[model samples]
Target chain A: MQTEEEFKDFILNGHLHYIPNVSIDCAIFGYHEQTLKLMLIRHRNMSSWSLPGGHIKRSETLVEAASRNVRMHTGLDNLFLQQFKTFGDPNRIQFNKFDKEKWFEITGLTSWEGNWLMDHTISVGFYAVTDFSETVLQTDISIAECAWFDIGSLPPLEFDHSEMVKEALHTMRLHLYHYPIGLNMLPEKFTLSEIHALYETLLGKKLDVSNFPKKLIALGLLNKLTEKRSIGAHRSPHLYSFDREKYTLALKEGLVLS
Target chain B: MQTEEEFKDFILNGHLHYIPNVSIDCAIFGYHEQTLKLMLIRHRNMSSWSLPGGHIKRSETLVEAASRNVRMHTGLDNLFLQQFKTFGDPNRIQFNKFDKEKWFEITGLTSWEGNWLMDHTISVGFYAVTDFSETVLQTDISIAECAWFDIGSLPPLEFDHSEMVKEALHTMRLHLYHYPIGLNMLPEKFTLSEIHALYETLLGKKLDVSNFPKKLIALGLLNKLTEKRSIGAHRSPHLYSFDREKYTLALKEGLVLS
Candidate 1:
């Protein structure tokens, strides 16, 4: 939404075009140079940060809605996305905390009872991983600011978002064992040490450096290239790249890596 | 619902007490004697089978609604339940196939365009594992029949349920590698071969017999008992049971087994 009229109409009659009582929230993880970060946004008239979210359109699928939300905020597309969980606690959104006065100024309404936007909603959570250095953050009329924060140091978020981030990280780490990652975060041809560092940073732990690369090679997801990058005297390490066919197959039919 | 009046009220005014446009479907897997089965139900006016499902109450969480649906059909509780996926496709439900004449008899309405139950609904898919031998199947006014079908010989299902089953089984098998299973499917005290059979049946594949038990032992999820089961005078094998503390810990914080 861009204009005041659109915002007012959405708050009042969005259910005509979008599904009511159902929304989609995304936990977009950014990785670059062995540093991990998360994307968060602050809505207009809100004091705290929150995950970028919106309701599903009446004509779109769940994943399409999520992808659209992510694309709108990050200016990136085709990221590796996966659904982590669906959260539906009745008390998840405390309505008493809603800023009714500010909303009244925008919506021109004193009471929101029986409104489509005031009902209890269930949100589907999706997680995506992309290279932070490649994204250009964007904001809309409803969002006051959009930025990335270090994973270790994050401000207190609004609603059940803190729990959503925790669950998203846990599920993403578990998925590392089953699915293939690092497609967008790494160069087309990289060294073993580079990929190892990527994995360690995403997992938030140290892996046995010797055993990590070997597992990926054994799974046929990686292929050794004859080329090598020269850094110093007697310090050239062999280069490797993902086998696109095998990597795509492993993604569809999961394979154990650890 | 048990009576005609209650069913009529649910179709006409259920949105007053239940959340509309959100439902829950369960893929209940039953394991007994090296055989795996799935629970399927047929509605009163439908010919095709479907995973047993219902809507969520205003006061209940998502999981609670799923548990209640499972309990109503299986006559059991506290099974190992998990949220596999939430399905929301625009064309997932074929309303043209709906038996409008039969519904008209109960609802006394020729058109259900604005009815709460006739809207596009998104269903949350949950998978559960339990011992089928312990459950006594029951049906309500809406369900005409409920029974267990061997997993390998399931007939065609309705409303994208076959896809739901495929996804559910894929997730359950993937979960087998991370979480502790076989808690309710196996006897309190079982032989290594017994658990081995159970895994094979559920995975629908053969595993190397030698390496399976050792992985469980190394994880500290199993304890060997001194007593042995005497199948023959010359062939007596040791019995083992789950380490409750370690198993519970593993369930909370997942561990790799394969």
Candidate 2:
């Protein structure tokens, strides 16, 4: 929503268009220059940061809703998205923290007891990996600010979002062994050291040099180009690029990389 | 629900106690004696079979709701449950197939257009693995029958359940590589051939003999016992058992078993 009236109407009548008590929260992981970061947003009415999320529309699929939320925040489309988990603890949201009087002024409602937005909500968690350098973070009227935080040093998030981020990172790291990634995070032709660094950064650990790349090559997800990059005297390394066909197939049908 | 009045109340006022527009569906896979099967339920008012599922109570978490549903149908508890995926296609449910007149008679409502149970629902799919031989199938007032069907010869399921089963199996097989399983499906101290058969049955394919077990042993998940099982004359096999601590730890902190 972009206006006060729109936001008010959403609070009052959004159930007609959107599914009530269900939302989609995304953990957008950004990778650039071997640095891992996460996208977090602060609502205009909230004090703490949260994963960018919105209710799923009646006409949209879950992934479509997640993709829309991700695109709205990052200004990037078609990133690799995966649903990591769903959170549905009854006490997940602290309703006592809600500013009832503040919301009543905007919504013009005396009591918000039966409001559609006040019910127990279960959020579907989706994680996406993208290159942070290419993203132009945008904020709507509801969002006060949008920024990237280092994954290792995230602020205390609101509600159950901290657990969501932990689970998202765990699932993403596990997926690194089964799915082909780094297509959008790396250059068209990159050296083994570059890809190894990407894995090390994402996995948050040091891997044996060339061991991960060898598994990718054996899986036919990577192609070792004959051309070599010139860095220094007798220091050129062979360039490698992802086999798009095999990479796409591996994404659909998973494979074990280790 | 076991009574007609309870069912009617659930149809009309379930949202008071259950979250609306969100449901939980479970694909309960049963493994026993080198055979794999799936649990399917048939509603009393429906003609086809579907995965055993129910609405999440307002007080319960997602996994708790899933566990309740699985227990209601299988007479078992504390199975290995995993949330495979959340399915939310707009057209996933065929509303036109609804027996509106029959429901109206049961609900004593003139028009059922805005009923809590008739709205667009997004289902969270969870899958659990258990030994079929131990479960006693059950059916409530709404469910006409519940039975275990062989995995290879499943009947055409209703709604998006066929797709749900496919995704559930795909995810369960992928999980076998990352998480240790077969705890409930195997004997306490069994031979390598017994565990090998369990893996093959669950994966629906052949695995390299001694290769998979070797990985498990190296990971400290399996322990070799001095005791051996003797079958025929001079033919004996070493007994092995899972290290419960390591297996539980591996289940929480996933490891690459391949």
Candidate 3:
């Protein structure tokens, strides 16, 4: 980590080389084991959590900045991402000054204990959907912890990250059925029950079991395999997978995620 | 109009109170006479026209800034507004230096002419929908003219404002039928044909006349007014208006715009 003077210089002088007063935050939503999760990071010496985010370099587009942050925090790449919203309230940065002071205290940076970190800034919010089972959380010197939290129960986050997460969820829910987002979260082949569970997790409510399957089948984006899996007590459920060509065509035509 | 010294002071000192590297642009789209249009403004002494935009103030939210810009460019209030996208390409601002320099030259500013106006800034795009017949263009000292241009035949705009307009149109189209936006652009009492014209203008295509009315009626939000409108060489069409209470209920239930 840089000393107080170096950090101050990085803010006042070096930051000009990047896009000043602008940041990008990623609300990486993942699906695994029939649950939806969001990736969050805790800065070194800070107790409050926040989404993995950083400033945009002068040479990069906003999407590239979000992609870089997702890779840096999750050790995963080529994830499906979308820009959902931009949060630009002037008070967003300074809303968590107490957290900053606590962080400074633990880090022993007395000289840097001021409003420098709480300057007015705007943040663009991007969300990524990835397979939670394949992602490995990565930590750097500045990041004390990086992990996925259950969507239903998230801890208090610094700044307006909680609001960002809420907004991302709302946008995703609005676009979920119309887009092929859930398909990317599942494996190459899965059961009907697995896809239904993913939708329930995202929508935060159990769908009508009998009606949902019929609706999904009517959409005709899936191919039922001849093989079946038999649970100990239940009847055998046939395996199914997305027909890539049909799925793409349905997505292009704005069909519901079936 | 500010003098050279005043302009310099505004740029160097006054702007410090606002977020340095973030701006807001307004793409005010209007519907009038079966046509869609966009509002554009020309800065004093600059040939290139641009959207009405300004840096976000430290005391205001992004939506407030956008609302202020819409009011500044068009003398209309309580318009239907939404934030569509953010344009953050580093080269978006300074790419049009000749116009910026022209603005500086006419303002009689020499001290702050080099790159002060060309700073790296990210612009949050907002779009407003309004009845075009009711809006009056407002021009201030810094603005040479404010005018509405037909969406189908827009003149060249400065920087990336044209791209912003295109993006806003695309978003509005996607959400058009899914939201109650067309109601805001229509009068209190209108014929079915009038509403159809507005949708056609917005969607950039003609709808199936026989099917459009049936689809709208199925939503069950409009009231049949005991009025009719007649045009030359056309049959008199019955007038209709929204049942305010039922409309609000349908809107809350996420009924497609009708």
Give the winner by lDDT. Answer: 2
lDDT of 2: 0.92
> Could you tell me the TM-score of candidate 2?
0.98
lDDT, residue B72, candidate 3 = 76
Alpha-carbon TM-score of each model against the true structure: 0.97, 0.98, 0.83
The lDDT, on a scale of 0 to 1, for candidate 3 is 0.75
Cα lDDT tens digits for candidate 1, B15-90: 9888888888999999999999999999998889999999999899999999999999998888888999999988
Q: What is the TM-score of chain A alone in each candidate?
A: 0.96, 0.97, 0.81
Q: Residue by residue across A26-66, what tens digits does model 3's lDDT show? A: 99998887788999998765678999888888888888889
Query: How far out, in Å, is residue B1 in model 1?
Result: 1.3
- Model 1, span A69-100: residue lDDT tens: 99999999888888899988887887766666
Q: Write down the C-alpha DockQ for each prediction.
A: 0.71, 0.89, 0.51
**Of models 2 and 3, which has the larger lDDT?**
2
- Residue B3 in model 3: shift from native, Å? 7.7
Candidate 1 stretches greater than 4 Å from native: none
* Model 2: residues with Cα > 4 Å off, grouped in runs: none
A best-first ranking of the candidates according to their DockQ comes to 2, 1, 3
Clashing pairs in 3: none
| lDDT of each residue in B1-258, candidate 2, tens digit only | 999999999989998899998999999999999899999998877788999999999999999999999999988998889999999989898876655677778889998777888788999999999989999999898888999999999998889999999999999999998999879888899988998888889888988996678889999999999999999999999999999999999999998888
